[model samples]
Target chain A: MDLGALFGNFNNFLDFTVGGLVIGAIYALVALGYTMVYGVLQLINFAHSEVFMYGTFAVAWTFVLLHGTGDASWSLGRAVPILLVALVAAMLMSAAIALLVERFAYRPLINKNAPKLIALISAIGASFALAEAMGLRDRFAKWFGLDDNLANYVAPNKARDVYSNPVSIQPHGLFHIGGYSVTDVDLVVVVAALVMMFALDIFVRRTKFGRGIRAVAQDPEAAALMGVNSTRVVQVTFLVGGLMAGAAATLYMMKIGSTRQNAGFLLGVKAFTAAVMGGIGNLRGALLGGLLLGVMENWGSAVFGSEWKDVVAFVLLVLILLVRPSGLLGEALGKARA
Target chain B: MLLEVDGLCVNYGHIEAIRDISFGVEEGTVTSLIGANGAGKSTTLKTISGLRKVRAGTITFDGKDITHARPFERVLMGISQSPEGRGCFPGMTVLENLDMGAFVRKDRKSAAYRSDLDRVFDLFPRLKERERQAAGSMSGGEQQMLAIGRALMAKPRLLLLDEPSMGLAPKLIQQIFTIVTEINQQGTTVLLVEQNAAQALKRSDNAHILETGEIVRSGTGHELAGDDSVKAAYLGGDL
Candidate 1:
């Protein structure tokens, strides 16, 4: 470990911190999907990672459709419209996939009164099936005789990393904090994520339908007695979570500039960790957990090595589970502030 | 009859909780099932509220068969339940909990809704005092009041209350029966399940005594209250 180097280089630490916050914002968005599904169903939607993965692909695909696979830079004015469209595309795609997963993978079991463990296994299976389906898009497209026409979307090297057509909104330096530049990309990601999180928190706390979600999460039978349609509530929860993940995907593509079929796997896991760290079912807890996890992971990489960044996240997760299983905020969605 | 249960049989995995129990709740009258804990009073209420599947029975509400209706459908059809154990969402305020009771009402923002809220407050001023307090943090008596008040928010034509006097002091039990009577007089048909025979029987217009899983006796509340056998078995041989 290079503690001496980490302490000696204050500028490097600030840069790492900003970078961590940027990625952390994305994690918070994805984690809401995980936490919300858990809140109502009490099942860890293992396939949720694939939902984010699909959304990232949607973002990439939307960019390709709007602005061919060119590396040419565009002015901010021209890029803004394309970015907005891509955001909507990503949201619709992810929300559709999330609803599909609920319908095909989980609903049947729920209808049959299947055990929760069985549902979890089904989620893991669905996750694999979704990832593999994306990975095998080339072969699937060839079977349908559309490979030649859709080569840009699914062709040579379909399984490998796919880059979005570059919309080079260069990271203009907004300010300097301790000799480290705070770029516009960091500001945009953090602010956009915060806006989405606050909107969701308000919806869950204040709105009537939002109250229905909380009511079902707390007591399904009681909610039914009070005339809350729990099935509709479940669908809405999945939809809301998917929308947040889609927004996160857009921000991620804006910053990272690329995506792959399986990119959601690692990031999804990281977001789940963030959810657990914050308190799995608490909305605001996700925000706090994601930001904290990002900063800590980045700091750990600096002290140790960059390769050990993932290790830092898992280690923190284990520690949190052992010490505070309920998480930093320690409240389920049902018990959160009214 | 506002509600009728004919030949109702409910089972929990082959163990009959309620066996061929048939009763009718008259409109605007309080009907009570007074029995021991394991005599299936709760199961019968649960079946009527659509929480439990009937093995063999027909439950007709306002002359419409509701044997297979979902719980929420029953609520929309003007049936509501203040379930056993006062199932209040602990994370929400008393007001939110009450709001949940009116979940199916489309006129929540109207003056009708406001008057309903006022009625609940008038019925249990204690709930109004702790309107913003979390339902879970309240005393048991207060939660029970909230439960009944919440059921009222549905403006139900027929109300099902399971064990409303289950866990309370003697004084509170008397107070609850009084409110139950009051709510019945206000044009709501009440179906009550209780272990407190004296209080329940005194307030009920019609009463059934359940034993094991069947109704053993049915009479006017005054007749059952005056019966020697009922007094020996349920009322400690005296009122």
Candidate 2:
């Protein structure tokens, strides 16, 4: 409604745009998991949110384990190595959780040819189970007599308390674009996300393993006849998705500075929306959708106030769906073109 | 025999789709199964390729009992199928589809693999022209070619083709059957399932006629093609 107020301050607009992009990068990474899984199995792994959550915990614990806590000052060179370690730790944890979810929650149902609705219920159950486990981490640690320091770091309280980043890497302005300054955080988030995405794109297009994924996505029976182990492909898909989500989790921690037991829930929903917006089963679409959604949400907040940001994002999704039901890039993942 | 199915019974849930059908594909020969839509021809091939579970059967490939082998294991054991409905990966390019067929092979980048690819391209020059094109975007006939060519990429000793001519033009169907004959002559055993009985029987070394879920007749290709009842039921009477 306040169009003039929204567009009047060009610098503010630019700042919001950059902010949106930083968040969008994380969303894109998480959304890739959703899209890739949907492409192959046609099942939305609702537990994927918990996978991202575990990654956040992994990052936080890694910093704690390295004794980097409480606003520790470090040079850029040292900070980079610590961040890399956290990223790897997060990725491994998330991937492990994802595989476990697939093994226990989805695979049995798939093997049994259970109803799609049943699989969805199983995913929701897994999501709740994982979230609750994280929420009750302190109780479990106490009961098990976990190492005092490690337990304190992993589960500070029994409730859903925020876990602040232990490593404090100061943000410095990298450059100015259109009178809006870009920070190191934004640069890292955007660049890292893009690099991972492009790498995934290349893997899907060029590698034999990736070809097996596409084949299974298109026609599992045909793929099996051709000697593609559909089970392995499905497992690898989960692992790849989990790894990307983990990377996104690390970037999210870097930008937001903290995480909670339920942190992944809202962001997971947003990322899933991004996936659908780009086209639910498409990889490139997830990227496009995430960035666009982020920009739109920020611009909407400028116009309608911050409280209306979520409304704006959802509204935009509705409008986009009305115009292009398949999504911006279209649902071509399992049908045609990687 | 390159492949053997004895007393094979397959069921979809409780209802039996294929019932105690026994057949064999001799090495370096083309065997055809001609049947109506629900005559269990596809089910038979699927079971042989390990895509369908056999309720009661013994499948032996090159003297190895493969009754419990997984689909990929079957493929690794030199059995490949261009399944019913031309099950080409629509998302993949023609070349990618071929690469997927060779998924179980260790020498995918070797000269042998390259020569196999060349052999496929030689068989269907259209595929070579559209190697980078998505399989879904091609014509039905072209997809059929890609499916068969993809199966050939596996370098299988026994090729199982189900309904390769199912939705093709008559001319294209003839071309596909010709290629099947050529593939057979190249020393790969073929077990082809087709609705085009006349062409199938003409090219095949042996033939079987399936009705409902059982094989009601079986003989050499020429003998079945000349049989009066076979002509009336499947070959449009005059033939």
Give all candidates' CA lDDT scores. 0.89, 0.89
Of candidate 2 chain B, the 10-residue stretch with the lowest lDDT total is B83-92
* Cα deviation of A318, candidate 2, in Å: 1.1
> For all candidates, what are the clash counts?
0, 0
Minimal lDDT window, size 10, model 2 chain A: A147-156
DockQ of 1: 0.83
The recovered share of true contacts, given per candidate in order, is 0.90, 0.93
Best by TM-score: 1
CA RMSD for every model?
1.7, 1.9
